[model samples]
Target: MSLLEQLNQDMKQAMKNKEKDKLAVIRMVKAALQNEAIKSSHAELSNEEELTVLSRELKQRKDSLLEFKNADRLDLVEKTQAEIDILVDYMPEQLSEEEVSEIVKQTILDVNATSKADMGKVMGALMPKVKGKADGSLVNKLVLQQLS
Candidate 1:
């Protein structure tokens, strides 16, 4: 099933199961998907577009989780982590750091990226290949390490 359909089904299940946390996260994802569709004037989003929205939501949760941890807000940290876990179930399987490093190495070779100056060129080519599979900051760090 398409992501949206799966989400709808899961939302219904969550409601029936009385899974308050899961239901809330699923609703937030749906709202984000709807907002994205409205912004682009599309009747429906492609799976790739939907994945992008999911990734963004997951990233937001991770950032919030970090902040909550720093502030010692254990309750919020636990809640944010639960949301992250829920969102992760819908994302593509993440790439390992080793796999990402290999791709970045190959990309640098493909682009003949000799120095940090070509970072942009390397990143432009790499992001599409790794989108939804790897986190951007991790990829960026790998690229910088490979280039330098």
Candidate 2:
């Protein structure tokens, strides 16, 4: 099933099971997906698009968690982190740093990226292949390290 369909099914199950935390997170995800669909003229989102949405949501949660901790709001931090956990359930398995480095190394060579000036070329070649499976910042860092 598509990610959105799976989310809808899970949302119903969450409601039936009285899983408030799971239900709330699922609802938030559905809303974001729906918003994206509407914005994109009702086209169904590709898996890549779905991953993009989830990544954005996860990042927001992580940012909020940090802010909450800084403000000594453990309650909010816990809540936001729970939401992040739920969102992460649907993401592709993250690649290890070593695996990412291997791919980055190959990409750099593939694109003939010899210097900092070729960063864009390397990143453009790498991001699509690693999308959803690796963190963008991490991949960028590896690519830079290899180039340097």
Candidate 3:
């Protein structure tokens, strides 16, 4: 099933199961997807577009988790972590750091990137290959490490 269809089915199941937290997250994702469609003037989002939305949601949750941790708010941290877990369920399987490093290394070769000056070139060529599979920040770090 497509991600949107799966989300709709899960939303119903959440309501039936009285899973308040899960239901809320599902609704939020649905809203984001709908908003994206409206913004792009598209009737429906492709799976790739849905994945982009999912990744954005996941990034937001992770940022919140970090802030909560810094504030020593255990309750908020736990809740944010739960939200992150829910978002992750819909994401494509993430690449390991080693796998990302390998791809970055190859992309560097493909783009003939040398030194930190070519970071942009490397990233431009690499992001599409790794999108939805690896986090951008992680890829950036790997690229920097490989280039330096």
Residues 1-148, candidate 3: write the lDDT tens digits.
Answer: 9999999999999999999999999999999999999999999999889999999999999999999999999999999999999999999899999999999999999989889999999998999899899999999999999999
16-112 per-residue lDDT for model 2 (tens digits)? 9999999989988989998998898857988888888888888888889999999999899888988888888898899999999999999888988
Name the runs in model 2 displaced over 4 angstroms.
none
TM-score of each model, paired residue for residue: 0.98, 0.94, 0.98
Residues 1-148, model 1: lDDT tens digits: 9899999999999999999999999999999999999999999999889999999999999999999999999999999999999999999999999999999999999999999999999999999999999999999999989888
Order the numbered candidates by lDDT, best leading.
1, 3, 2
- Predicted model with the maximum lDDT: 1
Q: How many backbone collisions does model 3 have?
A: 0
Q: What is the C-alpha lDDT of each candidate?
A: 0.96, 0.90, 0.94
lDDT of 3 at 109: 94
Ranking by TM-score: 1, 3, 2
Clash totals in order: 0, 0, 0
Model 3: pairs clashing at backbone N, Cα or C within 3 Å: none
RMSD of each: 0.6, 1.2, 0.7
